[model samples]
Target: MSAADGSASAADGSVNALTSALWERRPQTSVRIVDAHAHVGPYSLFFIPDAGSDGMVRVMDRCGVSHAVISSHLAIQLDAAAGNAATAEVVGRAPDRFTGYLTVNPWQDPARELGMWGSDHRFGGIKLHPDLHDYPLTGGRYAPVWEFAQRTGCPVLTHTYDGSPYNDLPMVDEVAARYPDVAILAGHAGATPNGFDAAIEVARRRPGVVLEVCGSFNSGSDIARMVREVGADRVVYGSDFPFIDLRMSLGRVIFSGLTEEDRAAVLGGTMTRLLQWRSGRE
Candidate 1:
């Protein structure tokens, strides 16, 4: 794919030129195409052996993704502080291209971890995985995270899936209602196209709730619907990289049939503003 035309010349996963041009033109509109959700390290669950920050950067360069907000497997799967430190180290190496979301488990000294990680400029937000942590979103133990977000005006991206007893949108909505000042990003927005509407409804009911679209499979039409129902500002793009292909994830946004301005907001503008809630940290 060359910039002269937007055609995919081959299926080698290379970005076509027209696609490149579209992303390249984003800065003129004062928005960067930022991936709001992503992860690094060896994921033991899915058996992904290894994918680090360097590999992530290579994919971003090819796909015209200006930056990515990332968490680490250590944080999500193993230990929060270790994963956060690993992520911070990676971001420290390429501060211009990467930012971090420090992962924290509710049961693990939540307040101390939140304070320790949140104070670092390299980390712009927080990431939570209730499924991995085996906790409910509204559980009392998780109160510190919500309180921290509310007080600091930081964004929290939590793993959410609709139709599940755990990690569903309704649970996220309950937390959002309690902390109106905190911005909550619903991870994957339901985990598939079918869950989009439920996630959209959550965002509709709570203005502070935002949808992070980053599942293994999502449809372009679903993305358009999200923009329409929740408005583009409430929807953000995230490629669950290494776990999923980044190029394919970028394609969803490019072909979602969104207006340029709305696309810009979904791609990066909204996240930029959300991260900025911490006094322009990212």
Candidate 2:
């Protein structure tokens, strides 16, 4: 079905159809599935045997995820230039299946980094990891990145945690307040049970802010609650990919107590709209 078509109803046994497809390791064609937050390449701290683009595509195909927006581990943690280059190569290889987030390090020349790929179609958005970079979301260093996003109307996905001095909900809210044109994707949605409420409140307060449901700490019930509280349109699905298994993360949404329409919105509809917004500006 098309992303705009929300005809899949619970009474029509759509949930059962999705569950069966998921169990069989087949694509669920009933709705378009998109992974809003994912990472590529190996990490310094962990072992991911299949962390390459090919492996990521294999898993995405298995889970019926049509598209993924990813940033490389090297870009967020180690080197933004090399990591972003790797991400561009992945997108170039499979443009239909993948789009990248231009990772910007606040400590580095963010404006120059953004200028290099700001207009590159391979990148759909910008990614920030304040915690790993040891920078606050509201820091002056990120000003250029925020300005670029605001000017281009690009989506910015930033890692957020509950009460994290770097990227907590309050910090995100402050940035979102200033850059109203940029669609701020609150990555991980605070990342814990205790943080979900705060994430919800921030999303409620900021129309440009959207909640990304991922992270190993969240439950399906938490996703349902977020949907109930903020409405399905404000929540998007993310799997952190090789960092966490895609299968289990997807299962949480499929098996959750959400209607087929809500599930569709979270899985792809919202992200599709966000990406389209980016494309339109370009």
| Model 2, global lDDT | 0.90
lDDT of 1 by residue, 1-282 (tens): 475454333321233333655566431223378989988888876676459788878767766788888898888987887888899998999988888998888767777787787789888889999988888888888888888788788899999987666688889888988888889999999886667778888899999999888887688888899999989999999988877877777779877877767877998899988888767443
lDDT score at residue 1, model 2, on the 0-100 scale: 61
What is the per-residue lDDT of model 2 for residues 1-282, given as tens digits with 9 covering 90 to 100?
664454544335787788888677678878899999999999999799999989999888877889999999999999999999999999999999999999999987898889899889999989999999999999999999888888777889999999898999999889989987789999999998878989999989988899998898988999999999888999999999978887777888888878988999999999988887555655
Best by lDDT: 2
TM-score, per-candidate, Cα-based: 0.87, 0.94
Off by over 4 Å in 1: 1-31, 280-282
Clashes of each: 3, 0
Model 1 misses residue 114 by how many Å? 1.3
Model 1 score (lDDT): 0.82
Worst 10-residue lDDT window, candidate 1: 8-17
